[model samples]
Target: MTAYVGKRLAQAVLVLWAAYTLSFVLLSALPGDSVHNRIANPEAQISPEEAKVMLAYYGLDRPLAEQYLHALGGVFRGEFGYSLSSGDSVGHLITSALPSTLQLTGLGLVFGVLFAGVVAVLINYGRWRWLRSLVTAVPSLFASVPTFVVGIVALQYLSFRLRLIPSVDDGTVRALIAPAATLGLVVAAPLAQVLATSMRATRRQPFVHVLQAKGAGEGYIFRQDVLRNSSLPVLTLLGLAVGELIAGSVVTESVYARAGIGQLTVSAVNTQDLPVVQGVVLLSTAAYVVVNLVVDLVYPLVDPRILVEGRSRRSARWRTDGQAVESAADLPAGSARRLPAEVAMP
Candidate 1:
């Protein structure tokens, strides 16, 4: 267990390191510096000398290697630097926007999982192959509909046309419903598809057949035996869904005019705010790593066979001397050193 945990932590560190390095490299590769965007405005008519000064001020004149090293050093020293466009600390901006993003991600995941599970159960209960195909087809079709389209359509129908919620600037939980539902539906689609497939596969497992033969009800076998065994693949899919949620929210945030990290990221990129962009990239990467790590840890618990195998292998290794040690429970009852009655007789 210690070894497994240590290995996962090490992998997480490496993932974050790679994220930072890649963000730095990509930001460096974008043509032109931040200063150019400001001085290049034809209406502003800023002189060449002023542009040069602005460039130097922002350290654009420094070698790329030095700039990257300086930025990295700042990160290590707990200074994320300021956005070139907004004149705000990148860290501060991220902190302010993080709550909204986390809220969106969390809500979307919880509802998505529940919706998928319910849909899978209903589909299985129906037990009609044609109905299953039609139900399964909904998720695939919904998955194909881009998140942006969903957000827009939800805004149009639910918020505007139906007046189910306020359309603009309501700034209430009620206002969040349309966007969150849209995002959740998009997430639920893939999850439902995966769940349906996994549940069907679990139903065909030999143990499920054994359970059914033993007079277990379909619900009992499915809920007590099959679902637990089949959940690992569902977890892996959920982790991927988390990554998709973050990636897909960029468009969703824009459509909904939400003040989440996705919106911040779009603004940062549009204005060439390298510091803010890098910060957002790092934040998203950390989120992905944490989500995947959680899924990996949950694997052992959902599938106890992993730990059982480990213990079995360890016990085998411990008994390498070839001397059989009889467990006390294996001793004959009523002997001087008789085993406990439960194990010895029963």
Candidate 2:
């Protein structure tokens, strides 16, 4: 387990480093930067000498290699300098905006999970075959539509026509409904697709048929046998969904005009506020890495086949002979193994 955790941690760190480096390289390659833009603004009237000093202070006057190294070191020390457009510390700008984005993400995830759960359940257990077929098609429809369109349509109908939710953010729960639901729909599409596929596959396994033949109730079999077996892949999907959530937030925040990291990101990028932009990218990359790392660590706990002894399921002998096929090394010495019930359908 420790070794598995260490490996995942290393991979997370590598991903963060790669994302930071790639973003910096790409942003540096851009035609001009915030300093240049600001200097060109006649309204600010920043003199040539002042401009030179500003460039040097921000390390823009240095070679790209030196600047990259300095910025990388600064990130290591939690130093992101200042935002060119706002003239505030980049950290302060992000910190101020972080809470709103976090709230949006939490609410969006909740709504998304609920949507996916309902869809998955209906696909698996709906009374009418046509209803299940219709439910299955919903995910593809969701996946085909862009998130912003959903937000716009929801805004038009829910806020404009029906007045069910406030169109603008007033720092109230009523203000959050449309945007959260839009983001949730985007999240639900892929999650529901994957979950429904897994659940249906699990339904066809031999053990499920065995349970049914033994007169197990449908509700009991579905709850105890089917749900647990199909949950592992969905847990993995949730980790990957963090990326989608962050990406979707940019459009969602813009549509709803919410003050958040997403809005901050949009402003920073538009003005070419490199420091703030890089800070946001780095923060987002770190978040993505951390969530995936946590998921990797949790996988062993959720699925016994993922042996914490660093053995892959492919390596383990899978004996479904009503016996515990897991290694004795994974258990306390001399401990009696408790074999779990085998219930799958063919």
Model 1 residue pairs with clashes:
none
**TM, every model:** 0.84, 0.88
Tens digit of lDDT per residue, candidate 2, span 1-346?
7767788888998999999999999999988988898888899999999999999888889999999999999999999889887689999999999999998888998999999999999999999999999998999998999999999998999989999888889999988877888898878998999989999999999999999999999899989989889888988989989999999999999999999999999898899999998999999999888888888877877776576334543345334444445554556555565433332211
Model 1 TM-score, all chains together: 0.84
Error of 2 at 89 (Å): 0.6
Per-candidate Cα lDDT values, in order, are 0.79, 0.87
**In model 1, which regions exceed 4 Å deviation?**
40-53, 127-130, 308-346
Candidate 2, run of 10 with poorest lDDT: 337-346
Q: Please state every model's RMSD to the true fold in angstroms.
A: 7.9, 7.2
Model 1, residue 190: distance off in Å is 2.5
Candidate 2 scores a C-alpha RMSD against the true structure in Å of 7.2
What is the per-residue lDDT of model 1 for residues 131-182, given as tens digits with 9 covering 90 to 100? 8767767777777888888888888988778988777635788877667777
Cα displacement (Å) at residue 104, model 2: 0.9
